[model samples]
Target: MKTKERKQEDKINRDLAENIKQVKKVFQDCSDVIYREIQLSEHIQGLLVYIEGIIKVEDVQQHILRPLIEGLAQHPQADGEIYPLSFTRVSLSQAQSATDWPAVINGVLTANVAIFVEGMDEVLLFSVKGGSRRSVTEPQTEAVIRGPREGFTESLRINTALIRFKIKTEKLKLLDMVIGKVTKTDVALAYIEGLAEENLIADVKERLENIDIDGILESGYIEEWIEDNPSSPFPQMQYSERPDSVAAQLLEGRVAIFVDGTPFVLIAPVTLWQLLQASEDYYERFFISNMIRWIRFFFLFLALFLPSLYIAVTTFHQDMLPSTLILSIAASREAIPFPALVEAFIMEISFEALREAGIRLPKTVGQAVSILGALVIGQAAVQAGIVSAPMVIVVSLTGIASFTVPRFGLAVTVRMLRFPIMLLASAFGLFGIVIGAVWIVVHLTQLKSFGVPYMNGIAPYVPEDTKDIFSRVPMWKMKKRPSDASRANMQRIGKSRPLGSDSNEGW
Candidate 1:
């Protein structure tokens, strides 16, 4: 059987007998496909159709059954009439085509009724779907030091509502589609109606409609599928657990996607600099923000190339070091048999293994395992001369560097790429390090996040955007919107001296 089954090809003047007959054959053996045939007030005969798990029976009983069924008792004259009812009076456009199969599935999934009648050609839909969901709670990742602690939930509707609560403007438009034939996942495309560029909106919608994946378990699947370059290590879309971040992006005219079953929402048309920014940067004082930004930048480089630099510097460029420093390094390496490359790889890979194991194991045991394993192994290796004490120091610093990256997903990519760069540095010394950095930079320059260049505000030189890239300038001085993703309406808030502004102050 196909994943999606349609009950009706198109509207037909209903012969209740004929319609019910067709619906049953298509829904064969589906016990949850409930069909409750009853006269509305026993006056109008119609059938209520809905799948079981997707709806609340109590809502059906209270709103639908109690209203119509109880009303029937009050008006004995209307009993079993089957021709007319006041509830039918609510819609003058009752005869209009209800919706397509996808919409029907959407309504059913959301606890709606597809009411079928004897004479009406189109179905009447009523939304009543309800189920218990966890109330919006603080984000585990991307925790805030200030502002609303609530984050996106697994429910896509709830997530949209969270965004709507923050930005109540009518310009906040939600465009939706179904992806993943098997999962039939709900994907929402949200952007400000006026602020979002027409071309960018159209491009995003086009890409989504064209996707034909078997299942979209989370937003990452959609992000990966729609990205411009599949082989690129960098993320084109930024994922966030915070709704305010998404709201901020939407206000700036970037599109946000919320996938069902995942709390993390994906913000498209992002930049490399955007990934480096932590929400905390906005909350903190500017001086602290700038300091933190530079610190993160320093570590980001260290994370990417520290081990390789250590290996290359020690093994291939010993002459590059001063006499005293060279002797100290030579004394440490005097007993070890392995070259810098092998020594670095052994310690780095071991640290990585411990880090990964800590995450996968239970919270109680995972931390213990990682800590004990690292301490014990590093001590033993140094004592046995399998690796030098300095080698342990280098590996530890590299691990710390990876943690300093702001975005977790980007940090992961950094970790995965670290090895390859280390390999090259080992093979060709300092020359390989420069070649690797150049290759990464070249690849980044070509990558696009949605239609916006990923490397923009850094490369191709937009000087104004630079203030917000490596460091967060005072809010008043950041008078313009980021020009990277935005082409129209670049100046968001007016520029003024940050010196005297109440909201703008020293870190």
Candidate 2:
């Protein structure tokens, strides 16, 4: 049997009264929506609908209501005017005829004013969006010493504009999409047309279309939904609050996902090495950036394996340390009651709790709590013979090392992996640590981001790309983009350096 077609299809009614009734019914319980009936003339009438806090009242008054009513009053009886609407008379940046009822409803909800004339079947949607939004300021998360201070704002349009501001080219395309069935949150997949892989962009679009969640309040929702390996501890995508960072990634043939109401924009096809590199790396000289990159890499390893290595060496391989160092460690632990593993766990857990407390509490007191809490707790634990002084120092150093990782997502992954590695170390000493590390490396090599290798240029060993991975080689030397993210037009810069500089003088 053929199913009956739905009677209530989204068709605009010709009669203004019917349109208003249907719109009111659709927005039945929505107190935020404002509906007003305007007298275009003595016999003619029009309906205006918009949300209260979102739409700009002045723009609606000047561009839509005033001009619309005044123009209609003068040309009440146009001889052959189609719909007798003066679309050009309005002062809006953009106006469109919304023939479908869903479009009109969406327009009103998304901070646009919808105007319906008495006889016209379509309503005019004016672009009068205005709302309370955070102004562009220095990004709190991705702060840099030398770079553009401006960051993305909560507004989706503003974020895209920021991107456009950085890359003023027609090739930088922003494909807009509305996800979140109930929320109808706006999302944009931004990429350079000639640089970003077409297949990669299509894959991102497919994954986003597949999401059927009720709402998406932040970009993290999309990140989790579309990530290549959800179960893996490593982040398959990277997020940055700084617009310059987004611009840099876009220039690298990567795609950026801009979610409405979030300053943090997500970048696809990220690697373990990319997370360790910082924005300041590009701003500083090559040698300085390379040194800092190495420092970050070293600390990243320390954050993940330092405590476990300490436990494994002290408990199973004491002879590995010098005589004086071993004796000093033994003296510190002489009064401690718990074993090395137990002591490590106790200190690690306490430190994590303090870190979380600091973040969750009020900013004014949070720093104090985390710092004072750690110092007081560490001293008390050492004096009380609960944990050794060396153990306390090891945990403290490990906590400090985690902060050196530039990307928060990678930092979190490293922090989570610490526990399992520590357990393995306690169980089988250095062998267990090596086994766990190998397992992680295997998982990362297998993971894919939109079909691109998650650890691209590293596990696959693209030697040409090593300059940017382990070290920030000079900008002039980085003439090509990453192989995985870009299929064509890989050349980013030419061999042009200052004439007097060593990079160009010999050539």
TM-score of each: 0.87, 0.95
| Lowest lDDT block of 10, candidate 1 | 88-97
lDDT tens string, model 1, 85-138?
Answer: 334433223222263444544555556776666655556567665566667899
Number of clashing residue pairs in every model? Answer: 5, 0
Q: Which portions of model 2 miss their true places by more than 4 Å?
A: 1-9, 71-74, 78-82, 86-88, 502-507
Alpha-carbon lDDT of model 1: 0.80
Worst lDDT 10-window in candidate 2: 1-10
- For all candidates in order, the CA lDDT equals 0.80, 0.87
Model 1 regions more than 4 Å off: 1-21, 37-46, 71-110, 117-122, 322-325, 495-507
Question: For candidate 2, what's the RMSD?
Answer: 2.2
Q: Model 2, range 139-181, lDDT digits (tens) per residue?
A: 8888788888998889999999998888999999999999998
